[model samples]
Target chain A: MSTTARRSRLHRQEHLTALAFVALPVIGFLLFTLYPMLFSVYASFTNWNGLTAPVFSGFDNYIAMVQDPYFLESMYNTFFLMLGIPIGLVISLALALAMNRKMRGSTFFRTIYYVPVISSIAAVAILWQWAFNGDFGLINQILALVGIDGPNWLQDTATVKPALIIMAIWKGLGFSMLLYLAALQSVPRHLYEAAALDGAGAWKQFRHITVPMVRPVTFFLVVTSVIGGSQVFVEINIMTPTGGPEFSSATIVWYIWQKAFDNLQMGYASAMSIVLGLMVFLITFIQFRLNRRNQFSID
Target chain B: MSSQRVLPSPPPLKPERNLPDRTSSRAASHTKTRTRPSNSERKHRLGNLIVTIVLSLGAVVMVAPLLWTFSTSLKTREGVFALPPQWIPDPFVWENYLRIWSAGPLLTGIQNSLIVACTVTIVGTLFSALAAFAFAKMRMPFKNVVFLSLLAALMVPFPTLMIPQFTMFASIGWVDTLLPLIVPFIFGNIIMIFFLRQYLNSVPDSIIEAARIDGASFLQIFFRLIFPIIKPAIAAQFILWFMAVWNDYLAPIIYLNSPEVQTLQLVIANFNAQYAIQTDYPLIMAASFVALLPVLIVFIVFQRQIIESIALTGSKG
Candidate 1:
């Protein structure tokens, strides 16, 4: 074959080969994600139980969803859990900054802090269930020592969200801190040195050099946290199986699962699922736009 | 779809780009640092000492719960409810550890988990890497469109699809088996694909071009050349994917109703529900801890790499 002709043949072969390589995942996505998503969108508008064929009811489930107090309350609970993210991020950044210094035992401490992150949620949730036991649990015992009596944490409407928040922060600290630590490491040392030479104080150097460098990590953390946070089910399921005292700790995913699997309200649950997806996607989109504006101003 | 949220935005603010005074100022700072070395050295030492002490206390809080779980796993029933709440399980009962194997389906749970995690990660990773290699280096028609569409899959949360997916699996009679867990995942993980593709982008095209010119086929080039180059990235991603699969709870609970088929998470959760009513705290704690041991071991062994990979990707993510 002529060289040009052979080159053209190779190019055609590469195209086919690449498509063949990618075909599996594309097939998987179609079968699992896209197909299921389209099914869910249709299911949301129907009134079918899992056993029966769907009968289209035209926005009835979505209408009922807006008026459903349980749905609203669970969503609020999910949002309340979100309060932990900023608190966790702040503490994580501080921890990472502290660890970034020339200090001994940093590796030891990193591992120590990361223990909770690596722990399975089911295991940790079970552990925390015991820790928050009304009388003899770890938290109350410690509180009693300080002359402050702790409530039945997981059982109280007032304290249940806080309890979940505290645990969420503890579990997530290491992961975000590790990310922040990585972000801090990447800020060129010369940049910090330069900032210092320019009469930028420690706080100023931190504001300028550290914050922007870690903003991407922070943005990444918040976005992931929201997505993870929105689907907060395992901990709630394990810790407060009845969805906390008076349904205070019930999250959207927990509610959806209960409706579909337990109550057999498949169509309604599917509608709620659609709403949750929209909310997550919308929030993420807003974050990206906000982030872009921040980027514009910084530049 | 969970993987799509974090955009692989390269770290935006490289100071040298916008900070025109940075390099020259750094040189001046270096000379100035030499004149006041002792003064700054003392401050650094003091700062390190303070940070060390503060960090230690924080580490205690971080680790206390796991230590507490371990301690509780060794305690007698009443010892758990003792007024002081023993920090150490004095006169430890080693029986809970022994008894956990017989309690419910803990053994089978681990077996099922291992079967699922191993199958999904081992098989899934190969497909992910191949797709990644194709996406990264190979010439294909409409390549970017295909890649972006796959990425767009990440936007759809699992919760959104769980019911339909449940019905889909059920329609095929795959429910109550590990196949539901393993089959859907064996295709490839988009996140892993995205990361591996990013890792491969750093390699020059000349290498792949030279291999191609030598008449190496695509699969051969991937196995002999690309795979070795991307092995470290694959290793890190493999560990992450393995941990994710091993620790999965939601989907397993949705499908596996029979204890024999349940993953370790479900088994432990069942233990929590059943044993808690009887106040079998130690037994529950023991099972939960055992459920955690595999991932704990993996994390400790691969701590540096896992941490670094997550950090590297998080910034880019």
Candidate 2:
């Protein structure tokens, strides 16, 4: 064969090999992710029960979502659960700050903090369920030691959200703490030395230097945490299988699960899922825009 | 970087007027001191001591639940809910741990979880690395578009597709089997591919070209050269993906209904439901502790790589 013919043959082989390399992931993505995503959007506009043929019904499922009290309650519960994000961020940031200094046994403390992050959600939920038990829980027992009667935490509608939020914050604290510590260590030490030389106290140095330097990481944690918090399921599912004493802790995802599987309302659940997906996308987009604007202003 | 530029530098000479400023300067000097100890040094030491104490207290709080889980697992039923809540089990029942085998499908759950986790990790990692190699090094048509679409898949959370995916799997008769859990992952995970691609971007083209000149096929170069170079990152991602699959509850619950085929997480959930109402706290705690043992061991063994992965992702963001 001529040299040019051989070169072209080699090029064809390279292209074929590259396609072969990527073929599995491409196929998997199409079948599992892409097709399902499109089908879900289409499924939202129809009436199907997983057995019978789907009947086209425009705007019906979407309208049903507005009227569904359970859907509204779950939306409320989901947003309410997200209240833990700021609290978690603050606590983790404080822990990161405390551990940022070169102290003895920092590694040990970090490992302690990170243990929960590594533990399975089912296990954590079970442990916290015991911890939040009204009569025999650790929290209540501790409260009783201080002359206070702790309410039925997991059973009470009023305290159920708070109970779940505390567990979430506890589980997620180490992750953000580690991220902040990474960001903290990356901050130029000379800046701190310069500030210290100019008589900046601990609080001032922290406020002026530490906070501003870690803004990017803080933004990252906020966006990712909110996205994660909105999807709270196993914890609530395990702790309150019946949605926590009259659907008080029924999150949006849990509601979707119930609707889709328990009730077998595939079309309606698809509608809710589509709405949720849009909400997540919008939130992430807005955060991106806001961060970009903040960075611009800082510059 | 912009924040650094915006901050005003300290003045060369400033008149110290406030007591706090003097104290701050004294503390700074104390930090700098190597030889003679001063009064400010003592104060600084005291401050460090206070911070250390507070952090240690926080660490205890962080560890209290896991410790309680272990302690409760070893306790008898009565000791579980005893007034004043025993920090250590009185009788230290080894039976609770042993009872997990018969009380529920814990052993089956563990075996199923290991099968799914290990198969998915190995298969997913290999495919992801191959696809990443192609994306990072190989020339191909529509490469950027395909890669971009793959990255776009990250935005599509599982819940959005749960219904249709479930329907699809059920129609194919993959539901109620471990196929639904392991098959999709065997093709490769998007996040794993993305991470490996990022790692491979730093690799030089000249090295691959030299390998090619030495009569190495693309597959050979990838396996012989790129794999070893990115093994650490692949291992980190492997451990993470393993934990995700091991901890996964929703997919397993939705897909696998049989007690024998269910993953460890589902079994624990089932165990909790069956026993929580009866208040079998020791049994529940024992099962949970057992379920968490593998993950905890993996985390401890690969803690550095795990933390580095977190740090890497955070910095990339």
Candidate 3:
């Protein structure tokens, strides 16, 4: 066969394979995800409980969310949830840096750190609820050894979000550690050698070489952490029902969940989703722009 | 080995030539060769040790809750809230586990969750892989545009789509059945397909051409050739899907209202409301522990594969 004819035949075969590949997900995307998304946008413009016919109400749902105390409280709680990002980042970075060194039981320790990430959220939340119990929880019991009193973690508004933040950090740190560890591993051996030859110490080497090399990973981690942090829902919902004492830990997602399900205000809930989505989008956009300006990539 | 052996000679060169008496020479060499332990070196080693300990401790803390739950389950109601909480039960109450087994709804929830989780994994995986294979290996028209649009669509959070998805099922009278719970996964998943596509792309095209020349059809080639190569990716996706379906609260909560069809998570959530209130903490803990065992097993078995899959996918992207 002529080469041109053979090339055209191969091209046709590749085209067929791609069609077969995309068929299922494209259909699903249209049916399950896309259609629902479009429908919710329409639903947001209406005033209706899920049971009744949705009456077009223009911007009333959006207007209501603006003044809604629950919305404001939920928004506040989201910021509190974001406390996990910094706490997690510091611990994870410390961890990644530490584990980057040659050490005993290195693989085992890495696996141990990652195990929590794989465990189910429900199991983790339930376990923490027990540990955070005011009267006989293990944490309080431990604190008592030092002659310090422990507060009612889940019951008190002041400490509820903080307690949840601690849990978030524990669960989330492993993932960021993985990202940072990968970046650390990618750092060139020659850079360290060069630094050592120049009489630069370990600190100087890390500052001048490792930090610059890992900046892209750090930026990616920060952006993702914000995105994940803002969507915190399950912990609050499971650990402290009724959104903790006086709804103190009532994150936006939990409220959205409640409004849509418990309150049957789908339209209003959709508005909340839109706002949260926009907030996440804006934060992500700004981070990307900053990263571009900084020209951080070593690639 | 010889090259590394030769590498350290320069550092020890000056001190070794100065010694005459054996004992004095040994002491002299020790003094001269012991370079200053820089702050960074100490910090670096200390930091590594600290991280290992802290991570290990964190893992212990992570499992502490599960341990407590397990302990409570094995204890009597009296021991559930004991002061300075007992670390273990003396007799190891095998009865709590047995009681959980005997509990009718609990069993139903287990069966339902398993069915849903397994179904979601198998069907979701196959279809998603098929879609991903096409996306990765095939060169159909408008490929980049189509794939980009799909990625963009990921931004639409499920909360925004819940009402309509629920209503669509309800109008079709599919709300009460497991169909609502399991059917949507039949199509390719966004994350899974994307991942599979990434993996499939790394597969050398020459292999596919070799299969093509053997006179295999598309289905044959996919099943016989590509499937084995992507086993690791499939295993990773399977574990992820299992967790997703098993831990899923929102979808199952919306879809399955009947006690008979309720999943384990929904059952656990409803334990207080329906099964028991003023609850037996020991029993609840026992039930919760039982609920967690499978997920932990999945993680243990597939952790390496999962990590490899992530590294593989992340690199391709």
Candidate 4:
């Protein structure tokens, strides 16, 4: 009876010790993330100037959000930027395939491609800002060599989104290619040989074996790219200081940030943030369902 | 051989030197290529040559802009707009390097960034490892429940929380200071905790149990046994985390108003904003390159580890 009681006491001690080990992070989650999330939900209905108490304004912020032209424009521009996702994926996959082929100096190419990915976004944006200068730009200067005069990229709304998309593809290519290369490595070579023996050509083999095999990585990339694309701010901040002529380059996060800090419209910004959160949640959920269906059919 | 039956996971754990062994064997196969007259072998050789040429061209596209950035930093401010733009600056003005120190709070920004990133990463990593250990190994009440809840917090998105968080910090008067950036992070990063937990789960429970039987306390075991075993994982996560904090702009801009309190990226961004209009392109380029240099150096030194860690994250996820 005494030994049993001692054993129970020792177990309690272990439990408490483990809890102590985890206390800081658990408490931190509460104080930082959970508290702010709860506050955000409450603050969404108020008209807070951030200096004074948030006075509850009900659905006014939500109602105003729908009619806000800046919000709408920023929302449209954000999604438009995501057009780079498919472009980046296709380019990365092709690059991965090329690198996967029997080759020398593959590591050299891998490092070269990943350089842009590792560079700071702010720095890259600043460099690109100069590169997009109408007259003296690197891009236009190169285009001049080909007898083509490139249009001013960032100043005009028409070309601004495309310019951002091209930059995004260039920056993201190496990382995605690396992921795809790793995935390609794991695919059984015998499957390719089997397909070849069955008279399947290179394109047919790629379509049948390679594409399906890399689907998980594709899904991973797509989900992350969308999450990242939704929060695009630094480039827009650096390259197009006023949000690209007509707010053409402003993303949703950039809009929310401007509203909250610049204008001190914390409540209205909170409402928009809640909407963005839901949009992210909904999009991720839908993608998850789509992925499940794809997996089911493949199985 | 890649033909060996693949491990069910950790696919790219294949050594980076996987190619060198094959190259070493090429001396034996030297005769085969020399004697090769077959159409298939010829096609294969041609394909490799074509790929090499194309990838080299791609590499040029990848590197030219960075090279341009470095070159631009050395040009005269007026030379930046010079027609038939100089790929290599004519005079190679070495003055921007000296001028950039006075251009903004570049030195202060570097110091602030170093303090915040170094403290947060060094301390936060320890706390995260501790949390990961507790969740992965120890028997605690509501363990998975607590772990899952912390994971859920990650989904809230910072924009949704930045307002309330800002208010909370402002009430404490942490605005215009580095505390807002450092404090929340030092509590522990959920992503780091998650990855470390995934790493720890691979460790055999038997060894830990054996240690426990020897009467070593949990903290003792963690310090002597766990930390070293997971040192590689910790280092990978540390370097990535440090780079992230250094490159971060959005959070620092939101909190730090004064130039002195701002982080490195923010200071360079301010230079870009303030000086680009003044047509001080060389100074701005110089400052920007300085901000990028630290991470760029880290990447070059730990290139293999960083790439593998990233590749591991993708497959493991």
DockQ of every model listed?
Answer: 0.60, 0.50, 0.43, 0.64
Q: Write the per-residue lDDT of candidate 3 for residues A76-107, one digit (tens) a residue.
A: 88897887787788778777787766656756
Name the docking class for model 4: medium
Q: Which stretches of candidate 3 lie over 4 Å from their true place?
A: A1-17, A296-299, B1-56, B272-279, B311-317
- Candidates in order, TM-scores: namely 0.94, 0.93, 0.87, 0.94
Residue pairs in steric clash, candidate 2?
none
| Chain A TM-score values for every predicted structure, listed in order | 0.97, 0.95, 0.92, 0.97
lDDT per residue (tens digit) for residues A166-283 in model 1: 9999999999998888777667888988988899998999888899878878888989999999999999999999999889999999999999999989999999999999988998
Candidate 2 has a TM-score of: 0.93
Q: Would you list the clashing residue pairs of candidate 3?
A: A21-B134
True contacts kept of 4: 0.70
Give me the overall lDDT of model 2: 0.87
Better of 1 and 3 by TM-score: 1
User: All models: lDDT?
Assistant: 0.88, 0.87, 0.75, 0.87
- Candidate 4 residues lying further than 4 Å off, grouped into runs, are A1-6, B1-38
Candidate numbers sorted by lDDT from highest down:
1, 4, 2, 3
Judging by DockQ against the true structure, name the best candidate: 4
TM-score of chain B of each: 0.89, 0.87, 0.79, 0.89
Better candidate number, 3 or 4, judged by lDDT: 4
Give the Å error, residue A12, model 4: 1.9
